[model samples]
Target: MTLSEELLMAYDRQLRTDAETPSAIGIERLGPLRLVTFAGGRGFVTYQDLAGASARTISHWVAEALAFYRSDPAIARVEWKTRGHDHAPGLHGALLDNGFEPDETESIMIGPAHSLNVQVQLPPGVSLRRVSAERDIRAMSAMQDEVFGVDASDGNADAILRRVAREDGMELWVAEHEGAIVSAGRLEPVPDTDFAGIWGGATRAEWRGQGIYRALTAARARAALALGKTLIHSDSTEYSRPILERYGLRRVSTTTPYRWRR
Candidate 1:
């Protein structure tokens, strides 16, 4: 396999499978569809490739998964993750008809963690560290929500607290300036994989170009290295893509999510 392909497999094997929220969501086989349900009242459907499935079968899979989610009142939303490389026919139309809205088309990036794990110079008065205390986590999550344009979510903070209670390898990192969070991210070490996922990266709008996020990432990379993880992966948005790209991660593929929300 080519280097990029190798990195992609590393990502699937190491990072994606260990998604605490998504991975734990047990998979349900509905014909050709693998319906995934997570703890957060979220459902997801994804397949390696849909080459063998006929259009009718593909539609059937979509309908079945939707029915599965619709039947669950607790399921607030569902995301059908599609890879650009998948050969599933008529996926777009089927999902739209099923009341799924498309999120941004994200680049499926993969590469060496060490490449981006370098020492980034943080702006003056900015500092990075990992936090576990409830107070600090609350502060961090609130800042991230605001930076990323998301509403306040106790789910994320609760997840971290849950992880801390279980002593899970998940760690929350933040960049703080003058007692306020300016940037934040999470490092998740997937079991049975040689990689860790760097997720939930956000920087306050005014804090951009200040090198805080990079420093936060660098801190996470350092933590990953200490954990014996050699690779890192993230589903990046346009805002953080260039920063990660500068660190040597490549855009290997694209991920399109079809969302079904209540």
Candidate 2:
């Protein structure tokens, strides 16, 4: 197999299961789909593959999945996560027919942890550290929401706090300038796997291209290595995909999330 195919297989085998939802409160299966309910009134759908279902079957599954989530009053919104490499014919039309709007596509990046462990020189007066306190987590979450153009909400912070309480080996790293957070990300070491995920990476507009985000990523990579994870993975936006590619991570596939709001 090609290098990209090899990496994609590793990701599919190691991450397409419950490892994808470490903090999920509940999970139900519909065929090959995992219907996951998280703590923030959010629902998510994922699976290893579609099993080559015909378009009609996929449409039926989509409608049924919506009904299942709708049965739960607590589910405020749902996202059906799709991967570009899957044999999911007509999945997009099926999603839209059920009122799901597609979000931006992201690169599924994967590579050796050590490739991202290089030293990076931060801009003057900037510092990096791991944060666990509520106040720090909130600040970091707010900064990320702002960077991503999402409205401010407690859902992300609350979810992070819950994960912190679990002590599940997820570390939050941030870059600071003058005591204010400028860039941040999370490192989650997948149990019984050779992978650690660097997720939710964000940097303030003015702070971009200063190597602070790179430094933050390097810090997470070091932590992942220390925790015995040999691989790093991320679902990266266009902003961060190029940087990760420069550090030797391959874009093995793409993921696009389709959302339904109640």
Instruction: For candidate 2, write residues 1-262 as lDDT tens digits.
Output: 9999999999999999999999999999999999999987899999999998999999999999999999999999999999999998899999999999999999999999999999998899999999999999999999999999999889889989999999999999999999999999999999989999999999999999989888999999999999999999999999999999999999999999999999
lDDT of 1 by residue, 1-262 (tens): 8888888776555544324343354777676456777776878776555658877788878888898889989899898988776677888888898899998998877777788778777788888888988999989888887876779899867756766677668898988889888888999887667778788898888989878878888888888888998877788898888888899888877888878889
lDDT of 2 at 11: 96
Question: So what's the TM-score on candidate 1?
Answer: 0.91
Clashes in model 1: which pairs? none
Task: Extract clashing residue pairs from model 2.
Answer: none
Report how far residue 68 has shifted in candidate 1, in Å: 0.8
TM-score for candidate 2, please give it. 0.99
Q: For every model shown, what is its TM-score relative to the native structure?
A: 0.91, 0.99
